[model samples]
Target: MNIPKNHLWLWLPFVVVVCAGYFIIPSNTFVQELVAFGIMSLSISILSVFFKDWRIYSLVKVLGYVFLAFFAFVKLSFYNQYGVPISSSALYVIFETNSGEASDYLSNYFNGTTYLLLILLLWPIFFLLKGLFRKNKFQEKPLKRAFLYKLFLLLAALGCVFAIHKKFKTENIPYATLTTWDDYLTAKKQLKDALAIPTSKAFTKIESKDIPQTYVVVIGESTSRWHMQLYGYGRETNPKLTEIKEELVVMDSVITPHVHTITALEKILTLSNQENKAPSPNGSIIQLANMAGFTTYWLSNQKPVGLYESIPTIIGSAATHKRFMATDDYNYDIYDGALLPVLAEILKDKSASKKVIFVHLIGTHLRYEKRYPKMFEKFQTPSKDLKFQHEKAIIQTNRYDNAMLYNDYVIRALIEQLRRQDGYSYLAYFSDHGDEVYDTMDFLGHNEYHGTRPMFEVPLLFWFSEKYINEKGSIPKDIGNRKYSLIDFPHTFASLSTITFKGFDASKNVLDSTFVQRKRIIKDSLDYDKR
Candidate 1:
């Protein structure tokens, strides 16, 4: 065994690692990481003197570069998405997302700046590895003075760490990130396992009061009413819906409880309300309608492939019939119009006495270009007629309004199809949650921590066939003008389906005259009355 007497070159990897860590992480984290890396360097340098082979030293140098590069990449990506460092919540979202969601991000949100940042961060490490591997050998002999200098630097770093320790605690510096990842994965698995167990309980006390009919609930995605022409926006984004305004019952001042898809939909489909907000598996609108003897169908355009099933998928599984259009292709432009044909088939089936169909449309989720066909790209630029526009967000706003235009077509098509059916048909349309596509802020996606008002403000519309209106009497003239929250949806759906049970509350139903408007709550616990 030959040990190198001088080993100053061993300190180079430590310097690179510490410098890279400081740059990649947030400013608040730099001091703690610098101190940790300093201690690590001292331990490795002290132990390197006993090395038996020079090849081991070269291997260590290359591995150090790989570690630095990996850490930098993770930090950059996390910061870009969340505006904060990596944590348990961020890890949960990243690991739980399906492949389709991931593909959507890469194709749409992965811009040149992110790619350039990654390249800049990794280039130095690549250069170091290339040089080390080219020689096929590592520098083992280091000048004694250089070795002493490295030791002095470590001591200086330790002193600085002590100085900052009084001001900022170093509690989270050691393995918090890794622990958060592990905890998130474990919790997610437990949740998935829980949701997998069948929890649909038969309602012992339920009855149908009105004539059996086809009731359709069209759940849209990430569309705000602010972008729609039907809502008095300057853009002509809703040509179809606007033309048929006399036939539609457009609700006013409606907001969803949550800016997130799963959270908002769970409340909409279940007996969950603002006062008693708990995810109830057995009491979903689907279960109640099924208990009331209505044939249930769940038709969706969202991805059906993923390790962890989405809550919507879990709830949809209880339906009697299910059809999913895509197998995790989120980037491709398979328009929401595809669901219309499947819906045509469902409407064609006259075998059932009654039917309750849940049509989940991928309406205007991110990558707006993929949501609609090219023909719906009407608002590409600022028009001379429309006044409200921002240069920074105009292009994105155009794409979003274009998506809304496409949404208008698909929704109206569903309504027209139901009208053509020979029965007391009814339809309700509402978005899962509104998006922040340059509405009140220059932001694009949901922000759970500080969500904006436009993030909750959504559109809720209804279309009742002439037969149902004539039989059940006209829908309250003021039903469309009522201010309501998405939490009222389950009760309203019950009214639309005419399913009466112990869980039915007319006061919470938006369509009922007894309906009461209260302070809207968001993110489960925040009061949004003033916002």
Candidate 2:
């Protein structure tokens, strides 16, 4: 068939749409959708030549453009913030969240990707609308083979829709919002059930032999030791920590049991050893602390999500008292300094003869720029060690280091506050997991799929008050070099608190004289040494 030469360029708009979706979404399913849409555009252009009903053709063209633009906007909005395709985890974290969290995330983290998406959308719309107005004569019908070939294209276009559904069973094509709500409800139900399931007793006997004292267990989030000068990084990211080095015992070879937040914390805050590393409903550090007659207090800078309580919050609920200092809502992360005032209040409370204080910090989770205040941006010069993979890589690295710097200040202040207080005081600190920030790789976050050594390597430190040091003697030198995982924290905590429990394993405690070095396993089955 002889078609108008000018009309042949109608495919340009489809090509633009495909290219735009590729860059903006940058996922396999998204590419599949673009391919399917491209085929539809091609078929429509070809069909316009054979069919004389202009109204029907024009309506189809308008609807296609509208769908394309709407789909692109959704993908672009989510991709800019998450840097990944829409998934169940993201859906639960977003929709199950409050307006404050959503607001914080949009205000702080939305970057250059927003503008790039806009350009991609506008370019395609320009050519597609222009092509719609051109007058066309009835082109001569082509060979039967040509019509069959065009018809095959239409089927293939529809097949792309099937291919997408096959890959992502829950995700809806053209309208991805359907999956967001569906996955959210499904996940919420699963989480609810998981929390409801009961477990058998983990401990048979429990006892505490120590005098009245306040023991502080501080848990940090997404902090990599590689970014801290205390761990020998080039930057002055740990000035406060360096100043108080004599009182602190830095465990140099410590790594977390998992690379993700909830997974690592689950193991860290439970009596789950290597044989039973999964978090048990029957046992947790708080329960053990509570059993030993120590009044437990859970104070945190990490904001609690609306109604959707996190695993940490559930675990923290075992404490006699609980407080969350952060007010940033869901996606918007806040500074850890908000916890300082609350920590002061907890320290002043003398009603409990023996107390266990658990301090959880927001601690450099993500959106690094917002994790610290302006005064903490000490690393002004671009880091020479960092290699860029993303456009904001350098800036992100700088912000991360600054966050670490601020974290150092917060921790040091806590230590000083504990020191000033009367009686025996023991403070131990470790992050839930480390993060990847252009360390060995060009990435700047932690994920289960792309696990790295830096992602599990975290900072572990213990501080003793002058009075406690004088009474109990200095912390053992062996504790500094001990290679251990946070999974053994329950055993170590029991030992430090002078608690004798049935599940307590002396060999697992790094401070214990009988401490044994076991295989450091991460992500449940993989050995850290092998990984």
Candidate 3:
């Protein structure tokens, strides 16, 4: 021990650990924010220190760099694919740039710059280690070094195994295909690179117009109209909205293009379908809005940094953008009320014209208690799992129902403010998808148990002020069965603006009157292609 410590070679392990922390802390936060991540990173780095083979050291460095580089690119690619430009400055503030934010932020915006920095730091180390070992600078028994090396190998091995298991293992699996290291390498690298390329750009140039008026699009998370009393549900989940029934157009049975907000919003703003990522912006909502004359913006509570941030492009196109804004408050951590005032202030400028703002809420995001203020915690069910306790599941459902109550109120304020504005007031509200809470033998939140992805069944509402509604014409008030999804979003808006463009893909647009039948977004991959 003393000899290894005295030798410069002994410090290699310490370097590995320090470097690991430097890479992770600046990029990804953990479940409990970054404190937990630091502990985990230190443990893995120490494992590296225990290994003594020069080749093994090289493998670790190369593998870590390869993995981290893919990670950074995936984050970056996802951000850009949205066809929106998320401001690097806003990311720095929300992320604390150097300090980093919570583990939760990674799902929200593009911040892969940190990972790129990490890859740069490790490249030199990789070369140095390779050089050090090739020179045979340390004299030691191969057996002893090999012994140290195997122990170190065990740590790296375990880390890889755990990650694979977490992602691939399912509760009901008798067996699942074990993905190879090569598969992970290929998958992530492709994900990152595919998005980075210009081929994925999905929006048209939107020119800023005369007179600034902000159009706020509040994208609610995990809310279905069936759960809302405002739409014909039995419960009183939307007492505020129901009270003002005259102002609401609660579109019932509005299915979303994708179950998740990431994919659904992509369809809404980009005007693309489930078939592709950017590379085409012709009929996208962002393109349509820009063409119709309006500034587009996206503010989220999710973190998509790097490749993942591409989803925000639905709101920020080449023609329209104010950059994406996120609070990094996932898990419903940000209060539903926080977005309203910020929007109100931004819209106050009288000189601005037809500004379209999209607010992606953390509304009803997991760990239900955290979704609302502490006072709301009183509504937690008697049992946490609620697996066997039907009573507790019902209670948890009630808590979520209460959150819906809060959402209705929050939205009411936003619409009222818009009504007071001096322009053509219209509000098109839609949930990316609905949440199960406790339905179908499952606990709160969306999951596969709800048949495919639970996040796809969202509630969509398009509200117009009295002046705008009367000036135009009213949609048929009959409660006839009409299916709607985000695919109709572009067509619906285009109907209002009446702009024609070749990029518009109406081959599947549901808003087209001739297409009386509504189609489900999810396809039956097997069993005869029926959805």
Candidate 4:
């Protein structure tokens, strides 16, 4: 039944308002995810309207249908996990694809590329099918109501375009709200402060070269500290590490500075907060590591092209102003195994003196089903319907755990593999932040639990190979049973590599023999790490 004309106005405006509000509000914070979701929404609804034809059974047509269905499903899943940002679905591809497995991402690259290409190709076919094959059976003059609907939709489209332009416009982001001189000064000071302070200060790199100790700090993604058995969690999420209790030291109380990648990882790499972090032009960690005579490498499973990682990736790619240090970059999206080939190459030559490899794994990241190849998901529930909340969460969590199991295997392999190396070698694995994983407040993933300990808490492990312990010291016995954050990483590296670098907060070492001295440590404070 047709609605009354006046009623249509109310309902239509209501629809538009909801459409704008849901997509606009949250997109302000999580622009990428929200944009992806928005695209998925626009694409799916547009497809339904334009491609509901009889010939959708063709292979190309089936592909178009697949594009619509898959993007919608993934986009909906992300919205369910991280609340819709102005309702963006741009990260929909990210959701449907694998995440947080640092090493495995390299292997998944070609597949991801193929999938993206297929999506692009399918869209054109869909457009062609709509434009060429669509039959306009209504030959009569267009009804006023239909015209009005089109006009309203056009207006809505214009609104969406304007909002998007405003969001993406270079002048609007991160610095957009600074409308006054005071705002500019505040932002400038923040930038200067964040850059100037050292995340890890050292004595100075004047000492003569000793036995080179290469420390690889691997940061896992979305890995909840609570899920791992090593972190004193009840679950056997880390079977490989659990069996080898003697070699690894897991710091159960390790917390993150932030929950979102942009916030957490940036601080981790820089290790500076408002008080200490002077807004210098260089990235904090990269700058410090170079000064300490260590080459820094950031191999990430996270996509470098996106917003969450763009800043860090660029910093890692840039030439460091300090000593012979370059943030030699490796795109982690190309499957973790692909990086292995590179690692094998790096180790095969054994040319570098002291190396610091930042292997950022997409560890136990979610939607969970996509992280592990199908073979590893045998433990995942055999259910396609994702509407049931509990079942879906359990299934996805299980899948994520299985992926963790795989990472545990890889880590163990790296451990054992490094043991074969002829030099003093060390490997440490921690996470950027933790996931909620249906355990805390029954949330599905990270970013939702912003500023909470569970969101920041991660499994931190330090390993000094028997060779290192037998050679250098006893893996610093005091390093055990201490709470730490990414804030301490640069200092810890300086201590381990024996690099006497200046401008570091050496007094706050997690491994310090007298590290118990701390002031009132506030929870969820903006200075979780820097202070």
Candidate 5:
């Protein structure tokens, strides 16, 4: 099994190229690069042995280098522009872009750094070509241990297959691209089917009082009640909301049925609940409001694309008018306050006698520091009661608290803007789900597999305008303490708006007199309260 030194050294160029490319890409990890190197080396070695002709093997090897080098360049350029890897959303946008738009993007993004990265990525070609040109004797005759060598190669191929399967299960670039493409196609088909379903079939009857009224639904993201002063946290993360807590119905026991954004929002905004896990045949709240003769508006600060078309975006499209502030994924520069002006403009519209507005905020999502402005960085240090004492955990806690503080300002501003309006309006604010930022565990993000209390306990607050309270009576004495899950959000929303249709369950409405306490299930399996 002795091999020539020249033959062994030939594969070194491929390994070096792959490792360099991975190191340059921000999204790739050290372990991923190492595994990728192993797979590449083993594959080339096996192929070289199988292909008896040296010229054909060299051609195959060069083709592999070309493929890897092309993707590496594209990924590096994308990272330079977006500070993130190329995602499905990015690919979707690219494919949808016209020639003019593509030109503009190239002109804007392709700069000195991009060219430098291309140059750095191209250096491996020289080494590869030099090694290919150097004359090395190929083993044309059968060796003594040919059977053993073939068996070893077979085992190596199986190991590579196992590694590839494991890597595909992760969030690596190759897996992301393939899965995103599949999801994009599926979502496109679902969106088409949903659009074809008539609004009339979704409801038997839609009845509401013919009066000038407005309802605002604010959907927040990754905000936990445990971190807010309004919920009795020691930090002043909710100073603005705390000042007017008396006027707001702060629902004390509300939780989301899921932790992820798309799953939780699909249930929250539609009639789909734990009992009915399938897509709701009855349309979303926006469609319901539209059927009820209210001019609906959907304004969002969150990106519309989550890998593919997010469920929230699909549902939001049912509104009479929809505007998403962020065009691309991971563009966190846009703040929630930007949505306020749009809300104000929508509130001022006089053409519609009745109005239902949905505002989605990117409140306190991961990379917490990017969620808020520098001025809102109020919490510089972590609290004394933090369970994890590491510097990174402490920083994350502070950043999250600061983001919460900014969110407080945004929510209070929304209430005040609605208060100045002339109609009977009530605004409901709730997060799609909460985050685990050094709370109950050392985790900083939400994971359904590793469920925790803070990841499901979201803040649900309601602000009733003075005129609305006078018209609809005072807030219920026991409404805030009612055990609630956001799966019944549309039912409660209908109750608040005095709207009724077929299949509307009064017991599911937290504010209704027939409201009943049901088991709050999370992740489709565990009881949230019992857990």
Candidate 6:
């Protein structure tokens, strides 16, 4: 029943390779990489046992270790540079990069830390090389014992496979990469088709006054009303917004239709709603604004492409002009405030009588501490009401709140910029979806499978200039208390901008006098309020 020491040593190199990635990869992807690499190494070790020749067996084992070590080293280097593992978004960036751009990226990212991490990760290769050169003979085992050992290895491999079967679609790197590529292709096709359909064809009977007005749609990411002081959170996470509380229409009961960015934004930015689950034939709000004779501008701090083909990116492409501050997902240096100068230039444009600007902020996303500057690290102390009082949870919650505080500054700055413009202007700010930073649960991110209240409870705020208020009439006193869903946001946005098209529903618009509250459905199944 005992295995030879020489045979046992075969697993050492693989283990070392796995440990390299284990140290750098995030906790979420840890188990997937562990199981995947574990199964591979075990299978290879078993296969190596069949090689009667020592040289061939050593070669196979060493080759397997080297192959895995190479990938591990690459992954570790990427993680060291980006603070994230090699993702589909990173891959897409690579695929799209020209020779010049690739050189630039290499020069920028391949710092001393990258080389240091790579050197550490590739150290396992030396172990494999030493074993390859060692004078060892392949010892043949007894027939029964050999069969039993093979059976045990096979059973172990099968068990690992069975355990990870359900998660294979999402957790496995190969599956995720393939699916993500397919999704990107599909989304690219959809985007191409969408762009082909003329604005006149997408929306019927577009009517606009062609007035000298400016509308700014500021979209926030992973921000929750549950953590914001403006929404009654105990922490002062929204000091700037609170200061201008009288001037803003802070809707209290707004929830996103979905917990994920792509799902929520696809519905929020288009006519697709609970009643109409299909892709909106009427195009996005950007297209609608374009048809209304408004010069559209999409200014964003977020990367153009996320893990998959970003629906927001596809929607944002419909704008008359677009400017993305952050080049890649890992570029955390670009804050939301970077969009201010671009917006200022757009606001100064006298070329268009009316302008519709969309500002997308990377607000309160994961790695919350990186979402803001050092000065915004105000919420260091954990709150008493935190569900989980552990160190990690407390730190995450504090970082999220600090990110929210910085988000307050960015939103206020956008509002002020819009106010300075000499026109009827209004700025609407809302998160694509909310994050769960251990508020009501012991979770730090949003997931559709384990849906929570904080995951869908987004912040929807509106700031209007005096000219906008005088022209469009004052916001209703009861508007803040209205139970609304972002699924019907396009209608509300259209109503606010006075842009109407065929089949436009006044009942769905929260700003309209006849606005009616409908059941807030999330994930196309659960009623959010009822849940």
TM-score for candidate 1 = 0.78
Q: Write the per-residue lDDT of candidate 1 for residues 247-350, one digit (tens) a residue.
A: 78889789998877766876787666677754433357777777788888989998866523677776776677888886746677768888899999988987
Tens-digit lDDT string for candidate 5 (1-531): 655443444365445445554645454454554456457566656655554555565566565665555655665566555445565655544443334335435643467877876776577666556645554455344235477778888888877767766763332345556777787677656654563232535676789989999999999988989998988888889989899988988888999998777778878987767777655354688888888888888898877654235566777877888788876443345578888888888888899989998999989876677778899987887688788988978888998899999999999999999999956999999999898888787666775645678888999989998888898888876678899999898888998998999888889888778999999988766788887
lDDT of 2 by residue, 1-531 (tens): 555454445554456556655665557667655655555455456555444355444445555565556555565566555556555545444554456545645555455766666666666556556545653453233323366776775676566556555653434333345666675566445434433222225655888865778888989988999888998998889999999887788999999987766667767887555676443434777877777788888897776663337666767766788787776653564888888888888888878889889999888877677788888777766787776645467788888898899999999988888888867888999998888888877666776556777888899999987777787678776568888888888888888888877756889888878999989987678888876
- lDDT for each residue of candidate 3 in 351-374, tens digit (9 for 90 to 100): 546766667776665444456765
Off by over 4 Å in 5: 1-50, 53-135, 139-184, 195-200, 280-282, 305-308, 328-332
User: How would you encode candidate 6's per-residue C-alpha lDDT over 130-202 as one tens digit per residue?
Assistant: 6666754333333234677778877876765665456544434444567677876776676556742326366
By TM-score, the candidates rank as 1, 5, 6, 2, 4, 3
Clash pairs (backbone) in predicted model 5: none
TM-score, candidate 2, is 0.71
User: Which has the greatest TM-score?
Assistant: 1
Q: Which regions of candidate 1 deviate over 4 angstroms? A: 1-68, 76-82, 85-87, 106-116, 131-199, 202-204, 272-283, 306-308, 383-392
Tell me the whole-model lDDT of each prediction, alpha carbons only: 0.70, 0.71, 0.51, 0.52, 0.74, 0.75
Q: State the weakest 10-residue window (summed lDDT) of model 6.
A: 136-145
Ranking by lDDT: 6, 5, 2, 1, 4, 3
Deviation in Å, model 6, residue 22 alpha carbon: 21
Model 5 worst lDDT run, 10 consecutive residues: 95-104
- Pick the winner on TM-score between candidates 1 and 2: 1
For every model shown, the clashing-pair count is 1, 1, 52, 56, 0, 0
Quote the lDDT for 352 in model 5: 90
